[model samples]
Target: MKDFLRIKVLKMLIPNQKKELILKQMKDKMNKILNYFKNLVAKIRIGKANTEILDDITVEYYEKKINLYHIARIEVNHSNTILIKPWYTKILPAIEKSILKANLGLVTINNGKLIKIVIPNLTEERRKELIRMNTRKLEKAKIILRNIRKEYNQIIKFNIIDIDTVNIYKKHIDIVTREYICLIENIFNKKKQEIRRI
Candidate 1:
């Protein structure tokens, strides 16, 4: 399935259009999945948040910008609050929608351009439920990664991809997998710490 010579050549050659095209496609595939899970875990961190809303809320802070997700921060004093600070003073309504859409069940109280979010303390049952939800998210990321791998395999099986190319793809897969796992685990640890607090 691989031309050993071609693989060696690809290594030495600056990626021409053909190589660039394949590399771009593979990178896109990798980013699409990696970004999705990272976003999910970020949302999960917000979800596990008992007192703040960090889910999918964005803010429009620039001059007359429309996309609210363009700006947002991830900090709440004492870990029980989320503050949404917008750059634009007029987009409170839109920012509110982003926060609600995030669906962390946090209420946004607007103070001029600043929105305050108070995170609630998690009950034992709720903590367990959040853990379960995180597991599902991780599984979904795995499935997506597999689907991308399958696509790469298709290219390999068709004899279009050389060994070097396949190896490169495999390397990306390994990197993404490790990065995402670390992110997910960090969220888990944070939530577990929160749940353990009496």
Candidate 2:
């Protein structure tokens, strides 16, 4: 039976249930923040180690390798270049062809050894577009935070949880969401600065 009013005892159902529900809400916020900055993360993956960009690339032209992420290592060098070194030289042309099809401003220059790709600096127009994209992502993450609050309210509405306990959960959600938002904004600020450096 469902009780819409009176001591709803949301926690009384099970101690673990209450804890798990709270944890799930927190994870929702975490996922939102992670997804928001996913593209930015890909851009900043420029490190000394050999890692691939286009990690999600798929191959359809020839059944040869199926995807560049599977055959080549993507290394981001400097501020505007991606290095693709196929594990085997035989796939050099295939790699170049794949990149060309991507049309991501990638120019394939093979010195009979390795393929070097130059990621051009984002034009002022592109930078503005990226900024706008991230701002929208942040806004969506905030909206997710609001939805968590609504779920908390549902518990309170039916007296499922006591006032003190509900207050505690509310405070925890607020604190966690604020921290996540801060992280997202900090990342955005760093990327924005990089974009405008030139």
Candidate 3:
């Protein structure tokens, strides 16, 4: 209701051309934030056989460090087991060592030909801890959004002289910020559910 009243009081102080440019810039930044948040959530382990967990793990191959997925064929052999078959058998030990060094709390079994990663079931306490961690990440993303909104609002305030026009611009920023925040929250909730499920 307050926002509606403010909009009614706001005059046509700024040209639509300038307003659209500012809005486009803000939307671009918010979309980048949303994409980054999605990437972070994808890395969280959900007690299932998922190859995305190994996205950051790197193996030394011929004096070059390469991502695990680049050198091997990773697949879910079962609900709790990830089977990794390296293109070259010589890299098997290196891959196994890297997995152990990553400290992912997973068990790796090397059987000469391939490596098997057994994802452990999340204990009740561990699940709670993961939920907490997820919540922190969600909060961090929201903070980033708020900071972006603040930066844009400041820009609008400095350029626009009318107080009502400034308020209208700030309200638009708030609406976009809320939309992105809601998107991040939905993703966080889905991940929380995944962590809680057995």
- Alpha-carbon runs more than 4 Å astray in model 1: 1-56, 59-78, 87-89, 111-113, 160-198
**Which lDDT tens digits does candidate 3 get at residues 18-111?**
6777778889999998999899887877777888888889999989999999999999999899999999999999999999997667899999
What is the lDDT, from 0 to 100, of the residue 122 in candidate 2? 61
lDDT, residue 104, candidate 1: 57
The lDDT, on a scale of 0 to 1, for candidate 1 is 0.59
- The C-alpha lDDT values of all candidates are 0.59, 0.62, 0.86
Which structure is stronger by lDDT: 2 or 3? 3
* Candidate 1 TM-score over all chains jointly: 0.52
lDDT string for model 2 (84-185, tens) is 777788777777777687544445688767888766556777666666765776677667666765665565444434678767766766676677667767
Best by TM-score: 3
lDDT of 1 by residue, 1-198 (tens): 365665455445534535455556666776776677666655544333332224334444544544443554445555566676766657767787667776554667888867777665666776776667767776776676667666555554454446786676566655655665565556556655655564
Better of 1 and 2 by TM-score: 2
- Score candidate 2 by lDDT: 0.62
